[model samples]
Target: MRRSAVLGGRYVLRSLIGQGGTAEVYCACDRVLEREVAVKLLRQASVEERDRARFADEARLLGRLSHPGLVTVLDAATSDEEPYLVMELVHGPSLADCCRGVALATTRVAAIGAQLAEALRYAHDNGIVHRDVKPANVLLAEDDRALLTDFGIARLLSASTGHTATGTAVGTAAYIAPEQVRGEPVSPATDVYSLGLVLLEALTGERAYDGSPAEAALARLTTPPPMPSTLPAGWRDLLLAMTALDPADRPTTVEAVDSLRRLAAETEPAKPGFTGRTDVGESPATRSTAGSLPGSAVVTAAAGQLRTTGLGAVSRPAGLARRAGLAWRWATAAVLALVLVLGVTLWSNTLSGRPPQRDTPAGVPDRVQKPLQDLHDAVEGDR
Candidate 1:
């Protein structure tokens, strides 16, 4: 656990990051690649043939999965009777760290949920199941993207590790799926259910199912998750679908991911639209070509608003269509302004108090009178 141990003849251990029931994760230096890496070593006391195979299986599965949202496995081997996995060292706080007491921002929670769902989908597509999905398994980097980690309990669909029995529970109590608790076979749906509970905890900053481990695991057999009020639109429904008792009632991990991504977009902060507003540190060319997406769903709304001066509230994307849209708004403004000015002039002329000038009557030119009638009709039509 100290900072000087080396592993696999290359990774020099720096410090212990954290530990789980099966493994201890350490921050290490990959002297071969000159980069910092994470090393997961099975605790000496828990080391066994079955445990070692499961640990190695996780590394092999992760080695096959290449995703930006997933923590990359660099190597796995038995070093001095202890099996270890070298992985990409992520520098960030875990989701659990962020959700210490108060609920995180809905946008952040939704975004994390979306990404972890994506990672799960990737694993599922490759015949692996992350049996555990909770706040502790998700890391939040400075980039704000969620990184999924710790597949220590993942089961490969095709290979029989023979570690878990058919009827034995295998996940954390608070976030365990009902089927998992009953010792039923697991699928992607199991991860979905667990992720739903994790999302609920993230949103509420409290475990929806709380009690002793036994009580929590057994409660889901009959008690449904209590529906909450005042959530973002469609969020409650999504969670309900995810945590449904029957696998058929739950959304697939892919579907859950899509819903979560949409929810994230909906709850994101209001981003400035592509009008022409200058952003700090953004070059004019950059602003025109690459409109800043504040990662929100409000771009279209912001784009729809053009000020009276024909300038947009934010720099718009560079394209003929954007120019055309702006041009259309200007044209509309010009037409409205002309109509307004003409109407005001006509109204003032009609007022008897200002009737010093000769009124256009019987002797007036046909052009003037015709235009007047046309304008009056146009104004009336508008009303």
Candidate 2:
């Protein structure tokens, strides 16, 4: 029989929300505060000496981070025979749930992706790498907020805990980086790669490399992705840079983040009802809505250029298997291109008889609106 709840002095577990390889997260109530919190309990069977240390490490990690888009750690402790972390309860859907039902608008996806990048930059700067980043870990909070969760498999620079064969594979296979597969020491670049896959899933409304976990992992080593033409043009090179087979070949996470920010800037004038900070070469109306993501995470300039190095400087480890992986990418790309061509041809035929419809609204002018209302004004005044 399973216990329905863990009744503690300060907190009471309501039900389990998620169970991973090492930890099980529960929805709990803080008896003192009378508020809900997520209590992540480390599975006793999974708690090795290193895992216990890692559990303790999360408190220190969360202490260093303060961001609106990140899930905050409220408290941590070990009780009876369980180690638990109390966290902010994010009440909303997962990115995976969103993707399964709806293809996110490009701007919305960019907004979410940008926020995630900002969080990653902050973590990387603080010498932490969120080794496992995936859709399930991202929460769409109420009031249209995008929050990142689940730092259980995160790696801290000062810790000896790592997924180097002796440990279980850390990340979801679909989002794992190439270097991680080879058992090489990981850096911020690995996070960039995983985030790239997140962005890829965001855009395509499908997995970038899909199949069994084993097949997907094999594909990552050998798959040269088809050209960016299939993706919204804005995301092409950024994805290529992040998903490059060689860890050295991939752009630094900070650079990739900057590229995303710039792309968002270019998109500002085109999005309707935007009013944020404006920069040079942009209209003041657009300025108020540009780069002014309130409560959005920030990447300090120095950290943005941390370990400045160009892609292609770091070489993929030399091995027959890696070379074969490279060759496999070319082959996979060819197949992908062929499939793309066929799909386009079929899609063209479906719409061949109908006239093209304009994307802009019919009655409204085709121009960006100087949003008379801001988020704060709308939420506060109206309510």
Candidate 3:
């Protein structure tokens, strides 16, 4: 459709934003409301009963749901056998796009998971289940906030839209739960499992499951999802429980959010106002008191030992050069004493500024005495 076309008598289609299997979302101007909106239109061939119903189901479900972390659906209608939905136009790319080729910090991943969990908890409380919670389904704003979107595969608990199923698979393969893969009935745990995979990928550069759809789906059934060995202990524990094989063993949305919050708190950058800690590159000797140290103290401690930078008395680092400097000073004194003795004994007969004496040390060559004389002169001159 051209930009001149208008849908439902009020929305003017301007440009295409995204394309999916069942719908095309366009950036549109709301004629009646005088604002920008995202219009998701069903394809002409997809105007069949099943497709329209699914589109309508998403519209109705999202129209009633509201949260800071969820995209808002504004309106829904059918015009001449063509159905479309008007939604809030999110201004950023999906989490999948932002996460591509990057390894996110654990605290950041936890913050994103916390918001998504809160949104899911609200949906669950209202008798709705977001069956798909992959990275592509989340929109991230420029300010680092995440908003969960795409309710195309959501199941309404009230059975009004007829989405309930057993032994039916309906989610992305890489992040789908084991039960979903096995075509079993799904609950909130299913979404939790999917989010767990997303978090795993976010924390680590690699995904837990990789391969074609068939291979990825079948592998999780027999083999456990990969648990990252390098993550912090709290992160590992939470992810393990979230991706448990059994739905009952998995953490609830509330519990998962709590765990994420705790993980974030533990990994959060140390702040003077908050009672939290950051474990990045800290040693065991300083880990306990790292958060309590001042900024200058941190820099000083990292640069050297717990020594004073002239602010007070300090302990010197046990360096080989400093120890050698003390040893060299003592050795220089002994060498000076020996050189003085040799100089007086060897040059007694040719003494300057003194009475001549007929005495010279036996078996001492002039070659050796000359070097000692130069050394004694240099040492005395230096003093």
Candidate 4:
């Protein structure tokens, strides 16, 4: 559609914002509402009966859904020569663009994943399964809120939408679940698996499966998605569970939302100038004390001890480091105390006019025999 072209006599098409294999999305203006909206129109050349039906299905599905994390459908016309859908305009970039080959912070991934999972939960609750839940279909609003869009291949669990027959794969291969590759039936778990891949990609700055579409799709059948050990334990566990080969083993959308929200809350960044302890295992009193200490003091003490003692290179937890430092101090104190006691005894013998022993052990060097004999005599006298 040309720019300035009017659709449904109310929406005026602007410039093209996004293009997919089946449709082109344009930034359009709703003349009646006097607001900007997104217009997704099926490509004229590819508008067949199947594509038309799928477009209609998406409109109907989105029309019934109301969620902050989901793009709201404002208007749709499927009977026209070119079918189009008008939706609420999202102001920011797509999730794919936001994290394109760039790893996002763990907290950011958690926040986005939580929002997407919640949106998926709502859709699944309403009998909708978004078959294509890749990053491109997820929009990031100005506030960084994730809005799931483009339910073009979504299936209604209550009824069969003839566009996607049983045993037909219908999503992007890189983000699709194992079941999708095998052409098995799709469910909410299928969406969970895809979301897992999306989050993994966001965290790792790379696709879990990369190759030709056929190769990517087939790889999931035999190998599990990679969960790097560098990822937080919570993230690693959740991603592994979400991408489990068996759908039955994957968490529900509700569970995924809970886990993601928890992780997001837990991994939230510290406020500026915040001196509070980040370790959750610390007691309230311990945290309060640690927080009360000057930041420089804590850093200096830990770093100085670690550096001087050659323990800085050891990768140990804070608790272990503290224990090791304490042990080192104790051992040093014991050695110093023993040396002090021996020195005091030798000084007392010398002051008391007691002659130091002349005989030295056979192994003792002649140059140091006087001092060695004095030390040995002091120890024997003490015993």
Q: If both were scored by lDDT, which would come out higher, candidate 1 or candidate 4?
A: 4
* TM-score, structure 1 vs. true: 0.67
Best by lDDT: 4
lDDT tens readout by residue for model 4, 1-383: 43339988999888877776567788888999899988888778656787788889888999999999998888889998778888888888776665654667788889999999999999999999988877777788888889888887788888854665454445654576767644578889999998998897777656665433334443455344644546666776787678766688788988898999898888544222211122211111100000000000111123213221111121222321222223343333333333323333343344346764445436544544554444445333322
Angstrom error of the Cα, residue 177, model 3: value is: 1.0
Among these predictions, the greatest TM-score belongs to 4
TM for candidate 3 is 0.67
| Local distance difference test, candidate 1 | 0.61
Error of 2 at 127 (Å): 0.3
The candidate, 1 or 4, that scores higher on TM-score is 4
Determine the C-alpha RMSD for candidate 1 after optimal superposition of all C-alphas. 28.1
lDDT of 3 by residue, 37-64 (tens): 9888776754566667777788888889
Clashes of 3: 1
Q: Candidate 1 residues 1-383, lDDT tens each?
A: 33337776898887777776456787889888899888888777657776777777777778899998898888888645657888877778777666644466677778889889998898899998888777777787778878887776788777654566554556654577767655568889999988897787677555555433334433454344543454543766787678776666678888888888888877443222212111211111100011111000111222233222111122222221121222343433333334333443443333323432233345544545544455444222211
Cα lDDT for residue 99, candidate 1: 60
TM-score of each: 0.67, 0.64, 0.67, 0.68
- lDDT per model, in order? 0.61, 0.56, 0.61, 0.64
Model 2 per-residue lDDT at 164: 33
Error of 3 at 2 (Å): 8.6
